[model samples]
Target: MHAWAMGAAVLSVIASGAKAEEVVLSPSSAWVLDYGDHRCRMTRAFGEGPTRTAFMLEQTQPSDTFSWTVAGPLVDRFGKGKVQVQFAPAFDGFEIDHDASLRVAEFGTAVASVTHEAPPPTLISRTAKPRLRSEPDALSDGTARAARLRLLNPEHGRSIARLTLTKGGESVSLSFGSLEAPFKAMNACMDDLLVSWGMDPAELREATTAARWINSVPLVGKIQEFYPAKALEEGAEADYRLRVVVGANGRVSRCHMILLSRGSDFAQRVCDIMRREARFEPGRNAAGEPKPAFFSTKISYRVY
Candidate 1:
């Protein structure tokens, strides 16, 4: 091997195998899969004690993408601001690029999370029918991207994942052992979750569309209305996850929330905002029939 190639190989080994200053944690707990009214989460902790790192992966529907959140003292390694999160886990042959939200507690612990989504640039594969005819708007950009993302589902024999959190020259990496089994459990939980929501799992797999937000431009401004007074007063920060049910009429029927930290006031305010202003283009099933679906996301508030 050339001098440079050998050097690079040695560096890889050092980064993955051992690095004292860098926090590299391995699984210290079993996966806990939770099926909630709005989402499914698979969680596992690495290392031990108060400083141990905890990871949570959540999914709300049958989709290739999922949300990943990590917490604990491991979070203290990065700055309180946005962290460069690179999930290059081979995520089943697909990659994810998005900004991760970071929160540092008053006591100095922190948490970071981000969701994976395939961009609109996903093109048809070689297997696509070359001569198939369809309406110009039938296969929209979003539709094609969803189809492509579905192929990256971790349940499809995805290997172990190493998620790296970076800030300038400093970085910390966490490795999640073979995720195939945990993801399978999460998928099963999701199937039941659909049933609890009165949705047919099989039919949803063939859905022609997922709920789309309408007039969401003002959403951020509206959420800003809350200001999360209690949290700010206590000098605490939090991020809340939510799922809103969209009726066949495309209006938000109800909203549910799960807190990442203590902030009930903020959560309540967000639900109120969603109920009053959230509108959507309802999802449709394979038979072109309107279906009730959910839109899930997370929101954070900063006092400054």
Candidate 2:
């Protein structure tokens, strides 16, 4: 959900430093629901390499509204300045006079928060005497303010297809999936959050008779090395999610793509790899009998 997690996955692959005869680019379109620390969020990420980015829509209990975050290298390019946001269908743009600061240490991400109406004075006085100004401006240096923007804005309407961010002569555009699925996931997460809050013991127990992994393989290196050359030439990066079913024999019974970044040979190649190369230990029941189990994971490929 967070850029840090995605970056860590990429870094792990890079650290392995493996080489393959061919490269494979993974597909994108995976949704993950996360709940923790009195919060719930529905998230999805896209792109690879420097373009890696993630969108997270979150809500806290007792609050009917939602807050969203767009993090990754794409947002960092805007720097700290005023940018214009244009939504499709109407193409109407809104001027956002906000601060954009980069967090290089935390996955090279940035936050864009709208400036507040009344900002507090700086901790330290610049001059020998405290100079008072006629009008005080909003502080636009932190993420505190930007976190207030509603994810579902009335003006923007539903079914937003694309978003364009422009700062002076530089601009970038991003495509979004249909809003229906994400909103549905968000509502489900909200329900879970409320249930957790009202639990009698205040501690939820884990589901019983769950599947456990005995032997797992790391596929990041193999994926990176096998990235598709056509995708590399086109500078395309994709995020893919696959549902893998393992039978009692400790072999992948079937693998299917739940999400595809874009229809291409690359996606087909990755799916083939998962079906042929992926292996997993069988899951066991409470009686210790081997049973079939299903597992899901997201894979991403980027060319630098």
Prediction 2 global C-alpha lDDT = 0.45
Query: Considering every candidate listed, which one attains the maximal lDDT?
Result: 1
Cα lDDT for residue 219, model 1?
68
Worst 10 residues of 2 by lDDT: 133-142
TM-score of each: 0.60, 0.40
Q: How many steric overlaps does candidate 1 have?
A: 0
Q: 1-304 in candidate 1: lDDT tens per residue?
A: 0010000100111243233345566666666777666667776666656447777777655555576777776566564555566554653323233232444332235454435442322111122212212112222432523322132255443555677666545566766645667666666777777677666677656667767776565764555555544555675656555667778888888787666545445567778877887777777776667777666655554444
TM-score of 2: 0.40
lDDT score, candidate 1, position 245: 71
Query: Given candidate 1, what's the lDDT at residue 60?
Result: 57
lDDT of 2 by residue, 1-304 (tens): 2221211122101111133221111214365777654456666555567656665666543222454566766576677768776555444676776466434343456453321222221111111222111111111121222112123333333455655566655555445524455555555554454454332111112112323333232443344446566766776655444445556675666665533234335556656765667665445444555555444444445454
Q: How high is the lDDT of residue 21 in model 1?
A: 46
Local distance difference test scores for all models: 0.57, 0.45
